[model samples]
Target: MTAHSRNTPQFYLTAPSPCPYLKGQFERKVFTHLVGDDAAQLNDLLTHGGFRRSQTIAYRPACETCRACVSVRVRVDAFEWTKAFRRNRALNADLVGLDRDATPNSEQYSLFRAYLDSRHSDGGMADMTVLDYATMVEDSHVRTRLVEYRRRGPDTAVNGRGAGPLYAVALVDHLSDGLSLVYSFYEPEHRDRGLGTHVILDHVQRARALGLPYLYLGYWVEGSAKMDYKRRFRPQEHLGPAGWELKDG
Candidate 1:
């Protein structure tokens, strides 16, 4: 293929599928390949424009009759530090999250399996194998990383790396504007520790430290209880027809 064609992304559409967030509704997605040398820049632009990247593809809901999926991003500087957020951080205080490369291993897959079994057994990725997990972590053309949350090891202070088996993992995309949490999972047995909430808290702090403005959290369906957690992070922006608009409460 010519360089010009490779550089210019081509968009496509998917066949209608049952909407995962809303009942009795169908969902369609408009997507394009996030490949070539300009992948990172393309990803950043698309994400800001309400697209989400999954490996080499960037897509968003294109449902003809539904406009429920709204793209969300947390304002790092103005995020609310409510009592519950502090409580969740204290609950998982003993753990440390070390940013690592976008490589997947057996341990992460094991945790991913347990998480799916406990929470998403009926979900789309319920039957993923180890190799599938690897592809999900490594097939990206744009920037990505894995933040592994683990128990603080003896030498944690010196090396900035955590210790022991992985308690939780977050697949992140490093964008020019901020960090995008592609996906995250934790040890099913440690649900009470609030690993998921802690991870978001950690990311929020990280972005603020880096002087980034927003922490992209993908789409939030207004009526979906499954996505209600995204609402807790205050001072966020929801992508609307005009553009990114601030949301209070």
Candidate 2:
């Protein structure tokens, strides 16, 4: 066998479970643990092959009879700033995103709990405690960072850190090709600010500044209202049978 196949990670499959995004449908996943020295490189390969990283595990949909989940990545350099995107940016101009180590804190947990309660109360992670949140942020074996967004203060220019209450948080993984958005949450009360769109727009800027080509946005499922917003970011590449194909407006 070749070196590529020799180092190939072992994968396992999960039993069928109720689909979170679709009604009356079941979902299964093929997953593998991302660990050891080759974790980062392996992660990049699997991600390009349509896997999503969650803590130390990398998984992709392996439903028996369904193929609704599709992986997507933004073409940062080619992304156009639409009028709606500009509006979101303008609305969230007062916020500053501070990149920090993947260490969890009580304040972040408070915001996480509030967000889950208000938005995803019936979702899978609704019962996640503070410890679960910590594990989610710190269990990663690859390069990871937490971007905390807060309202800018007078000292922001001097310290380069946001002040006041946390407005949103994004757990991101730095890959060789681009930034992978693992998970993000925002203050539910601030929904009017369009924090979700702002987070993605900020990541596009970050990818451009870092000279990366794509911003991995995980899986986008058709017929899922929660995932419909991902389609708004134009000029993205969708992973398909023939490989990544550009989907422009």
Candidate 3:
């Protein structure tokens, strides 16, 4: 049972694996493939329904006992530009994000490898090879873009592109209603610059500029300090039993 008729996607459940966020617990996922002519439409629908995409697969946690993986999205127009956020943005003012087609390259992989080795050494993606990273970037069926963060060059104003080595990268999906932050990585050595927060902040302004209402930020796992950063970008709407509910800053 791979797919159903009339473009109805077939759903499958993954076997339980050790939970990454919570110790002594397991994690399972219900997922479907995003393919065919309706891939983008299906992705839009699934993401709104609390699913997140990896390559061409759309999945959400199916852990029966735990419901901590909460889908979160930032309201672009209602976003709070707090003093801390302002300072963080100012800190990375010299860096610029250049949006390009979702094509994987060696340079991006090098940065990604270094980031994983430094910060997420024991995480799931720590063992991913260059080929895996390339597939992750290029295997998408829906509209996706890679925003490479680099230092601003002398001719940045003329060409509208960044300069120098890559410091951070964000894999984003352009949905019908919003831009989804699929995955992001940064140079772990520059921890003081808050590159992760900077990427999200840049996307918030990008969403506003594009007249998009939301910036889908995948999930926010409760009690996971690693997931706590998602909380700073407010005001955000958390998807729940009643759908997305707004939370104040």
**Clashes by residue pair, model 2:** none
| Tens digits of lDDT, candidate 3, 116-197 | 9999999999999999999999998899999999999999999888888999999999998899999999998899999999
The reply for model 3, stretches above 4 Å from the true place, is 1-3
Model 1 agreement with the true structure over 7-113: per-residue lDDT tens digits: 89888999999998899999999999998899999999999999999889999999999999999999999889999999998888889999989999999999999
- Residue range 1-249, candidate 2, lDDT tens digits: 645444568899999999999999999999999988889999999999999999889999999889999999999998989999999999999999999999999999999999999999999999999999999999988999999999999999998899989999999999999999999999999879999899999999999999999999998899999998899997899999999999864
- Candidates ranked by TM-score, best first? 1, 3, 2
TM per candidate: 0.97, 0.96, 0.97
lDDT of each: 0.94, 0.94, 0.93
Candidate 2, which ten residues in sequence have the lowest lDDT sum? 1-10
Worst 10 residues of 3 by lDDT: 1-10
- For residue 67, model 2's alpha carbon misses the true position, in angstroms, by 0.7
Q: What's model 3's overall lDDT?
A: 0.93
lDDT of 2: 0.94
**TM-score-best of 1 and 2:** 1
